[model samples]
Target: MAKHHLDPQYLDPNYEPVVNRSGNTPFGDILAARMQRRTIMKGSVGAALAGLMGAGLAGCGSDDDDDRASSSGVASTELGFKAVPVSTENRVVVPEGYSAVAFLPWGTPITGAYPEYRPDGTNSGEDQEQQVGMHHDGMHFFPIDLKAGGNSSSEGLLVMNHEYINQNALHATGPSYVNGLRPADEVRKEIAAHGVSVVHIKRDSAGVWDLVHGSPFNRRITGNTEMDIRGPLRGYHKLVTKFSPDATETRGTLNNCSMGPTPWGTYLAAEENWHGYFANKGASQPREQVRHGVGSESRYDWELADSGADAYVRFDITPGSGSAADDYRNEANTYGFMVEIDPFNPQSKPQKRTALGRFGHEGVIFAPVREGEPVVCYSGDDSRFEYIYKFVSSQPYYAATAGGYLLDEGTLYVARFNDDGSGDWLSLDLEDPDFAAKVQAAMGTTVGDIVFEGFENQADVLLNTRLAADIAGATPMDRPEWGAIDPNTGEVYFTLTNNSQRTEDQVNAANPVANNQTGHIIRWQEAGNDHAATGFQWDIFVFAGTQGTETVVDGEAVVTLDDDNIFNSPDGLWFDYNGRLWIQTDGSDDAPYQNNMMLAANPETREIKRFFVGPTGCEVTGVVSTPDVRTLFVNIQHPAGNWPDASDPRPRDATVIVTRDDGGIIGA
Candidate 1:
């Protein structure tokens, strides 16, 4: 049997049920009703009161106009390019009059001292550290001069996440499993392949982008790099380990997937599916460990390396005699949080923001920040029956203040969706009596109950986030992936990537379809159109699939998808400077869809048009546009598609830059 599990929660029989409220009714109906209610409330309020609030709400518009303009909506500057057709060919397919150039493939040298890429996979671990990491995912670009604003689009530091590694492609003769053990060198190289990469890139006068080799800004942060632990659980007893006796630091980042860019010029790399990387064959496992899917056998089996060094033994998180300071038992608690890296300051250590709460974090997106208003961020737990989360900064945000400090003090809340088209943001704080009661009801016990060993304090609540969510009755979602916020509007959108394990009885109002293969996008407007509001109204934005396969609610199509824009498993989502939404996928390259693709959509009009389709057996993900909006970059991961060059014996993952021939803004 294959030991690799994509998400261990899928195999758990006691998975919690997701909350869905708009079953069998067109999501639009629910949205329209919410808008009407808001309008009525506004009208009923005294005119004097409305006038008093006008100044503070000048830019915050109601969803009524957006609801009206969804389908026929066009950019102030229209996207006039022809749509790209679906393809089964082993090459990237783009719209007519557009051009693409492949750059920054795996093992590309960032530092001048590293050896060039060897197709035979013979690069040493040190070589891998100095070169670009493998499996590119979400990314962001930060200009060297922060004050330049849009003019700095041509020059910036491009930072991207190296999600995971392909064992066969990383080793000369493939990974070795000799009597349940791996070679130390091979394991080291694999560790070097995970984490994030920062490269200085510049577009020349000829309209071409190239990596600036040997630039001081170019660097790679691998799984072996030192990182600091911050937030609620920083120095908790659960995090003490031999590696960090004081429990204030940890080593490296693993399974970096999606990313988030902060207003203060830093990168937030999300850790996803990291539990499988560790192994604990001890007699008994902690409740939190089992909940997060830490299994007995290692996914990579790196713990069995013959080197006997602490670096190799850390993967085995089993307890030993004496205190946690003498063993690696608590090492696993150190991962699964949003790691903040200062792209501009290479010397700055990455900090794990535990206040965000950790459990297969897909990505974190901040809502519009106003001075003196709390900074709010939204994230989704990417696993079957997982929950969506929001964090509110305890202190208000002031742009003039340092940006890195905003995340340190905050309250994390899990979402609870009711059956009546309403939802609540339940605080995860252990001090809240109501929250504790809810947890007791869900788990059938009190906090003092010894059966649930870890719920001792605030630190425990932050460490075992998933368990806390289960106790608080948060609505489970269908594998929530990346999220994006509309710049022109305050609406929040999340991709509920497909769930094939849902049975007919398991279906909910939100996820109405059973065995959902093609996923849908869900959007919500916070109460009073405020990011800090605890309540919100939501509905399905688009149901992804071929034209004839859309799911209907109340005899009306939820959202139309067609041949020119069919897609599945919406994994990555981003909003360009022009307010255009870009959707990317990671799914089967079957007929009709042909290949994973990138699409352009007008969220206002619900118009989706196919923009580009990726090569065979490759995931099309990680999209970011320059401030000028004329240049776009997308990543192709794990290319079994053999894209960019089919003739090359060894295919490598790469980033491709797209531009219009007329030098016009992309998708225009």
Candidate 2:
């Protein structure tokens, strides 16, 4: 596939996204460097033998069961559950031994006095605030007991993201764009609907999870919520706006997709595909803004709201009147960073941690942390051709003193993978003259040249993270989505969710496919098995494909799907406490695969089994399990498949709680 311009048809498009338009000069440099190293290593038989036995070996039908042991020395066992059958039916289908229950559907009351959800879709903005939000995505279950070990099985605060609004199902008559403008109320409702929600939940005597109505912990952080701008870009000029004249504050977190739970007991809600919400009809957009796909037209036409309030006006990023402080031109920069929310403290203000370079952050997962050691977190830029990034805290992490403050100071680095299973993490710090020189050379221009534009400092380097990565010679990936680190090993895995734009010539040893309809999972072990290591050994763990169209690597099939387990577009990913890797998909509900589904994989044995299938038109995402491993929670998004109830006038996005019929461990 070829690179294309950002299409304004959908709010996110990242799920079915664009390719990086940046020239391939940097990638060529990486190839040249790798070829030079390959020539030297080709004659070393010992080196070749080591490479073959390295941690980077792809687990394609290999019996590496001994490598699946946890750090505590216990080996993982097989996934004993039967595979769930594939179907085009409009209901959730789980393995025969498992049971699925519809829980926390959109518009369900969580707090205050919201009227019951009307099938005709008459719920008001006020009602939605009190009720559950739409499009539930990445989430985590934070147990009430802080000291509880395992998966926090019994009760906890369920923090989740309401990604975007489905207009057709959100209103009685859908959104109305009359006379080139949207109704102010309709826009307000949409804004209120797109953010994060926190609901208190617990299991009862029957082992069914239920929402705790009117619980003090229940709250919603909508598009209008006040947020503090923390870290390097807090007082930077690029973040100045009428919302916060000093540039230390902004409003709300839009397009929240996946999330990460910090060891310090807070939640990191990622802002993905937020560029589509802005309408920057300015004469000439900034270089960074342009690189991020900010355009003249808003994706949801939210800027056309007929309201003069700053809340609605912020969506229009065009400069107006006096100076930067007098307008909301910089509002767009305030988003796209990981917003840290203290789930335990409802009164605490959410912080936008700018130290983690901004882009389309799909999600952030922390590497295993050790006391007195730097804390590391990894994230992916979901858009095609984007890069993977990691943040290393300046100070050591201590469990007792852990909090959002540690994230305030950090150095961000982008990854560049080599063909010989090795990769480098290039720091984004502009202070490093050597690093700056490499960036200049890669961009084929001097530091003060037009390529640098107005990006003069570290803040600029971070605000335009994609440009910096491109200039720094980082490797571009095919829609790198959710990432997870194996608890047993420090190995990192990223799902390169599919890129139709990747052509044959663009295919490399790592991303080895043309028109990559069924994506692949790439993993790496940090050098020395250290989370803070800047180097890593990499490999493709599994290549997702249909039953008949299997993917082969190095003369071996990485993973072969069967009739019961075929899937595509691996999106949401999570590794449970038990080390079972849960893979979720967000693909087209067509022939071979009629609906989005969730599958379980035993990484060691390279065995994947289909465990659950979502309804006809929905994407199965966000997954978590109880401490006991008996109860599992998965989110069903944009359910046009008429799941749960085919008779309902409008389909509802809800969370499905899965449990074994025998009340045993899930997927056992």
Candidate 2 ranges beyond 4 A from true positions: 1-19, 25-77, 147-152, 439-450, 507-513, 548-554
Model number with the top lDDT: 2
Candidate maximizing TM-score:
2
**Superposing all C-alpha atoms, what RMSD in Å does each candidate have to the true structure?**
7.3, 5.5
Relative to the true structure, how large is the alpha-carbon lDDT of every model?
0.76, 0.78
For model 1, residues 1-668, the per-residue Cα lDDT tens digits are 22445322122222322322212222222333332211112111110111112222223444454442322354432456778888887778889899988889998999749678887889988889989999888998787676344448788989999988887777787777666667788888989988999999998999889988778888889898999999888889889999899899999898888989987778999998788788888998886677777878776777778788788799899888789999889878998899999987778999999989978898899888898998899998887667799999998988778486789788899876654556688899877888877656645443212245436788888888877876776766768889999877777889988777677865443344577667778777788888888897665667676555443333344345667887887889998876778999876677778788999987655667889888777888899988777789999888874556666566688998999888877887
Superposed by TM-score, candidate 2 places the C-alpha of residue 348 at a distance from the truth, in angstroms, of: 1.3
What lDDT, from 0 to 1, does candidate 2 have? 0.78
lDDT score at residue 418, model 2, on the 0-100 scale: 79
